[model samples]
Target: MERPSLKSWAEAAPRLVAVAAGRDTADLVIRQGIWVNVQSRELLPGHDIAIAEGRIAYVGPDASHCIGDKTKVIEAEGRYMLPGLCDGHMHVESGMLTPAEFARAVIPHGTTSMFTDPHEIANVLGLEGVRLMHDEALLQPVNIFTQMPSCAPSAPGLETTGFEITPEDVSQAMQWPGIIGLGEMMNFPGVIGADPKMLAEIAATQNAGKTVGGHYASPDLGPAFHAYAAGGPADDHEGTQEADAIARVRQGMRAMLRLGSAWYDVESQITAVTEKGLDPRNFIICTDDCHSGTLVNEGHMNRAYRHAVACGCDPLVALQMMTINTAAHFGLERELGSIAPGRRADIILSSDFHALSVETVIARGQVVAENGTITVDCPHLDWPDHARSTVHLGKTLGAADFEIPAPAGANGVRVRVIGVVENQAPTRALSADLPVVEGLIEAEGAVCQIALVERHRATGAVTNAFVEGFGYEGRMAMASTVAHDSHHMIVVGTSRADMALAANRLGEVGGGVVFFADGVEQALVELPIAGLMSDDKAETVAAKAEALGAAMEAAGCKLNNAYMQHSLLALVVIPELRISDKGLVDVTKFETTELVEKVLQ
Candidate 1:
């Protein structure tokens, strides 16, 4: 379908006004509400909104002049009318649901707009996968804009992905209808060094007059960061400290502080605005990656707003962070982010600013949601059979595949371990001594064996390494196909047999998460779509995710958001230690490390 031309929309203005003036009839009219003017930061009471042709035609004291006899009237009953929330940065696949289901889950929370990067899917299916996500997003009741994925392997040579995205691909995608901009440029090193491919992608986005997303995962805000900024990324979401937030804004990049399902970055970074008095407009709130459980139970962008407010930001400032600030940064200020003329008529009715309970939601002049229920349809795409049958294990194996063999005549060995920090993205690299049982190294106390099983192809390769901070006590295992970037299978366990059982179960189910203990499966969440998302309803997925969480705790694994840590094991871009299909990656030096120790012959 072709988009309506701007000139054509402007030509219809007289008809819209005629409908609003009662000469013709409006489709919907909302009456008697307090308008929360974001531009002026004032709550003006006793206003009515008249909608025609999916746009706000009139908003004033008395819409009785605008309301025709046939118009459907909705009494707002003195609730606060605010523009619907917008997420500045996110990954749609992280919700473990398709775009349609993700829209259904967040619409009740008043999130009407989202800026998404389907990089995870792009890594698996390439440009075609991105187009599939974009087409489905355009079919939703709310707005879900796509950013062409910039980094596919994320870090070149560190890991191998199922597909590769080139500069030509980036150029072609810039012309896509829903392509908002380039996805997060995660390869900061590439940008700083002026790699031709990275510069070409940025040039394409700039030539199209769109935004460029950023991901500088390093803590060094020195010359390297300056070089990255010079390379032309307009916004960044990897800031975890007040200095990080302040630096990004000073460099003319919007500082996006995120509060995802696992990442608790807002509390530490919001102080840049609240305490240090930095310009709040330069900072935005986002949930970069949220699970379906967090969206359905806790909230979506609403949760991010409440978190910012709880962190001492003004309530109005928090709301702006999730709305206008985001829209302006993404170059969509004229189309969204405010309850103003010519903007898409997406508004939310709430009772309180602090609590923020959405009573009603309007998208494109239509009643999309009311009283925590979606009223409109969000269309879903029929996924191809190839996408569903992605999980591949060469052959089902026993516990022997998970065993890590030690060096000759070794009784004890010192091993480098990846330390999982609770509720944070970066993990610490620590070394520990463990007892060697026979020829195999065993996890004695706080450490456990983590394996990255190749699931993209039927390679049947498993890379084993040691990790700490999960605090697993019993002989249990947790396996997941939600591994980031590469989207392989990650299994963490104290017992090899249980790990094997968990991995084989995921292979049998096609894709999902599973927990096993003492030769029995405890919980499983089947995500058959691309092995990254489930076709089930949000509530059903959340319930199963919650059960999986409970099972993780019951098996003696004690870490906040351990499931997130489990998913990120294959993400080689992040610092410290990670495992890929090739070998164990020591990210601190960006080199591959062998599982065995080097010794004199």
Candidate 2:
């Protein structure tokens, strides 16, 4: 299908204005509402909205003159009429659903626009993956713009991916329809060092007059951070502190605070606006990564709004962060971000601003959702066979495959461990001394074994390492195919037998999450689509995910959102320690580390 051209929308403006002025009739009229004008930050009561040809023709005191006998009328009944919410940065694949299903899940929550980066898929399928996500996004009723993925391997030499994206790929994608801008450049070090590939991608985005998204995961706000900002990323969502937020805005970059399924970054960062009294216009709210469970059980943008309100942010200011600020950041202010004349007629009606309970949703002059239920069609794409058959475990494995050998004749050994920080993406690089038994090193107290099983190729290779902070107490193990970026298999367990069972179970069911105890499979969430997402509805996936969480708790692992930590074990971009198919990685130094030291007792 051909994309609707901006020229067509421009040419229809005169006829649209005539309909607004009562000289002509409109297709739809929304009557008697309190308009929450975001531009002026005022609420005007007893206002009516007139729509013609899927564009807002008039927004004023009365639209009765423009309402013809054939025009459909929607009675707002004194509700607050506001612009539909926009997610400034997110990953649609993170929802564990296709773009169509993701839109269906969020529409009732009053989210009409999203800026998505499909880099997760790009890591697996390259440009074909990006085009698939982009094409499906344009087919939705609401606006789902795609930001051409900037980094595929995310970090070039840090880890290997099923496919590698080149600078040529980035430049070509910028010209595609629905291409908003470059995706988040996760290669902060590369940008700071002026790596040719990273710089070229940024230059292409700038030359195309589009936004360059940023992701600086380090806590350092020093010279490296400054250099990354100078490398040309327009916005960043990796800020986890008030200072991080303040610094970004002070440097003329939009600070995006995210509240995803497991990432609780908004509370810590919103203080930049609520208490520090910084200009709220430079801030935006987003859900960087929300799984199917969160989208189905909790709301999407509505959840972010409520969280902002809970953080002591004013209701209007919170709305602005999710709506106007986001639209303006992507250069879509005039086209969207408000319920005013000439903007796309994407609006939401709610009884209260504080609670943000969306009673109805209007998009492109049509009612799409009402009272927590989607009332319109969101078409799904037919995923090809190649997408489904992606999980490749090189060989079948047994318990012996997971054994970690200690240095010869060593009584004790010092081991580097990856520490899982609760509700945050960054992990702690910790080292611990442990006793060795029979030349085999075992995870003794809070530490457990973490293995990255190569699944992309039938390599059946397991790179073993140690991880802390999960608080696991017994002979249990957990396995998941949701490893970030590469989406490989990650298994963490105290017992080798249980670990083997959990790993093989995922291979059996194609891909998803599994938990095992005492060599018995306890729980599983079957995500058959691309081994990354589930074809089941979000509610169904949520129920299975809830069961998986309960199984984790039952197995003696206690940590807030430990499943999120499990999913990121293979994400080599974040600092400290991570396991890839090659070996254990010291991400802080960006070098491969040896599993065992050459020493003897």
- The Cα RMSD in angstroms, rounded to one decimal, for candidate 2 relative to the true structure is 1.7
lDDT, candidate 2, residue 341? 82
Model 1: how far residue 38 lies from native, Å: 1.1
lDDT (0 to 1) per candidate:
0.87, 0.87
Model 2, 123-199: lDDT tens per residue?
87889989988988888999999998888787777677888888899899999989999999998889989999999
TM-scores for all predictions: 0.96, 0.97
Q: What's model 1's lDDT at 478?
A: 90
CA deviation > 4 Å runs, candidate 2: 1-8, 595-601
Q: Predict model 2's lDDT versus the native.
A: 0.87
- How many Å off is the CA of 309 in candidate 2? 0.9
Candidate 1 Cα errors over 4 Å, as ranges = 1-12, 17-25, 594-601
